[model samples]
Target: MKSTLKKLLPFAVVGVMSGATTVGALQYFNHDSNNTDQSYFTKASNVSFAGMNSAAVGDDFVKAAKTTVPAVVTIKNYQSRTSSRASEQDMLDFFFGDPFGGKGQQRQRQQQTPDNMPSGMGSGVIISPDGYIISNNHVVAGANKLEVVLSNKKSYIATLIGTDPNTDISLLKIEEKGLPYLNFANSDNIEVGQWVLAVGNPLGLNSTVTAGIVSAKGRGIGILGSQGKAANPIESFIQTDAAINPGNSGGALVNTNGDLIGINSAIQSTTGYYQGYGFAVPANLARKIVEDIKNFGIVQRGFLGVTSLDLSDDQLVAAYNKQKNTNIKAGSGIYVTGFGESSGAEDAGLKLGDVITKIDNIAITDFADLSMAVGSKRPGDKVQVTYSRNGKDATTTVTLRDQKGGTATRTKADLSVTEKIGAEFQSIDDKTKAYYGVNSGAVAKNVMEGSEMAKAGIVDGYIITEINGKPVNSQKDVENLLNKFSGTVQIKYLDDYGRGYQRGFKMP
Candidate 1:
């Protein structure tokens, strides 16, 4: 279990589960697709009658299940994990009193070694017959190799195309044609009470389908924030009660019509299993990410350049009210707290106290709504923003910008790995180990030409053995540890004589 799942949901699974963590490195399963044994499924919302017979909301979900199962896939991820990295549960325990919230009694669990390879499973949807698949980023985040198993038991090694951690969406490719796939549905038109099916391989069971309705839309569950990032993570989930489990990440969440509407992303649970709530990345946002990855090799996000928070939370709204000395209603609208230095808010006549109510024709009830609306567009895009100023409605046509406040289309080259990490490290060699008396470590191969590492006076051959307090045995270990870690870090290393040295490094 190298890179043991860094963030255990404490029953708060980010819609990604670990049902396949023990499936072994080279293990593969082929199962019969025709399982017709019916046994009172607890959740299926009724299928709607189109041109056929009349239907009710409690009708059988056979139609939606049958249509979606074929397009959903089980993905096996194989990645080298770090041996000494901490589990997400441990981190949560460090921050919160009870990892699974303050509910009931805390149960002790056995610990396992993390040096083993990561063998996790998740679900994905086939969007194109030519093998363009969409899934959550956490599903294939660190996978050195990815294997996608079709419902027909046919498996293909999937190629990683691009990933957006902020949105938890990734695009994958495989060489296949005329495969059973699900077309993207208009998620915006999906109502809150409409019937939907969650088709995926939960608990490693092939092609399981559960039924439920859209419980809520534009939900921000704080899962992405737990991973740590800058400028707030964009999340607008389609919440449902469709029984999402550990292995259901990246699965197809479809309407009664069997069209794809969302990708199951996280679950709101108590013990890391489904507990009447699950969340999905809306199809519109996922589709946009897929299109951007396919076209630009990077996600080109549009920015409104405004700092705002959702007024849906009672405490949040109360705080804003107290701070601003005004009575703002909760459960509706986004209260603009400030403007981004490079934002169009000021230029577009947006004030600090303005409350955003809508973007274009779409109603924005909270931050999730605003984020999803603006995030789906690209830099240089224009949108009509509607807001309230002292009970008076105001509208402005504003042009969005990138983080750099420019309208340039971003490519993969815009932010290279070197620019991200600041320094390049190499694995410790046998001779170096003998002289250094260290079991494993990474040698600073070369600091970036104008990187923070260079500014910090770090040089080549500086063997980095630890990041913060976690041991780093190799370059991959370093990368895995640094992925979601923001702010400042303590880099501990060994000199040529193996003498220890620690330095402060900031993640830029």
Candidate 2:
């Protein structure tokens, strides 16, 4: 027998266990009919509930689990046999902690099965009475079909509404109405040691409930960054000691009153099984993402447009002070490193050596605090930023902007197919087209990280001559060709070095 153990990274092996499954490339869908009102979930109090401070704080696990179990459903991921093989490679990379891992060895665990059979299983929480469900993006990323199974064993085919890779949340909908759902609790009010329940279908067990306490909050475990944009992964996980296992990915983390406080996401384990640590996405941030996807067809994330160094690291602070000949103290707050293009922080008079202390009166002691504060807002939303410069406190109101530095709120209709695919194109020059021996071509000007194009290995400077067998000479041509495609789309392109290649990705 061969040993299956692989080298684990030093940063605590994190397993995205969706119940012994294979994840695939993500496909996004934006349909007008699937859009719903933003007021689907009932809001809970931001302050403590009526019996939060009572002596019997954790004695009502039975009631809480009973109320929430019906709302938590099992999600099955079904992928066609013909989808790109890249998803298999990605899954291997996710499990083994290697980009090019498991290439030579054939996958022996997953045997060939019918396309109708589910390839993976996880859990989801119903947020609306009309069959709207919320689950982790990894749970249903590469599925050709999705099925939602209720606690009563009733199954319904689900439609993918929208997804936010940055937050690792995806929304699904069924045609049924008058379904049981969970209310959203203000996760910001949750404290350490508070009683909570993890309701999900873990290890193929349906309607399993586990009790635990909030061990920590605002934990950045570097989990979402592996699946999302490395530079902009919004990970302020609610750390809990719940026994969340493989099938609990998108399940509900509820309070004693059955109010949803977070979504169980990842577990810190080396064997891909639940150990002692589990993480959940706070309900406050998840609610914002759900509302954005429901109303705007995409997340309205705001960016402060400046990178910073954590002042908590004494050595890093000392090195920076020595390099710059400045007496910067090591303490709370993040020291500004640089500004992004068209930065709102720069426009608001924030400079590189300034230390950000607060955002909208909320304390910003580290990147987790800063990420949660800004990641929950929309573009054009203004935040009062308090910072320290030369040991003097100053305040400035920053008008937050989008990734492109725009302040306007954009809807799904505002984005072209090329943008949705995660890239922008520019018409190739006549000389360039002649050199490539093509009559018409377009160069990928900008490629968004963690996008379909990026997943398909498309990068900046790649010249695309055809999309879905149609000639693409300009940006408009690319969009027109892609818009007409529904399912897998094939592309004929040349890399930045003029090497020819072909790729395919699914679209809906």
Clashing pairs in model 2, backbone N/Cα/C closer than 3 A = none
Q: CA lDDT, every prediction? A: 0.72, 0.78
- Model 2, runs deviating above 4 Å: 1-58, 82-113, 228-231, 313-330, 424-465, 468-490, 493-508
The TM-score obtained by model 2 is 0.74
> Against the true structure, candidate 1 has what lDDT?
0.72
Tens-place lDDT digits, model 1, residues 125-147: 99998999999877775566888
* Model 2 lDDT per residue over 228-250, tens place: 34347888999887677677889
TM-score of 1: 0.67
Candidate 2, poorest ten consecutive residues by summed lDDT: 33-42
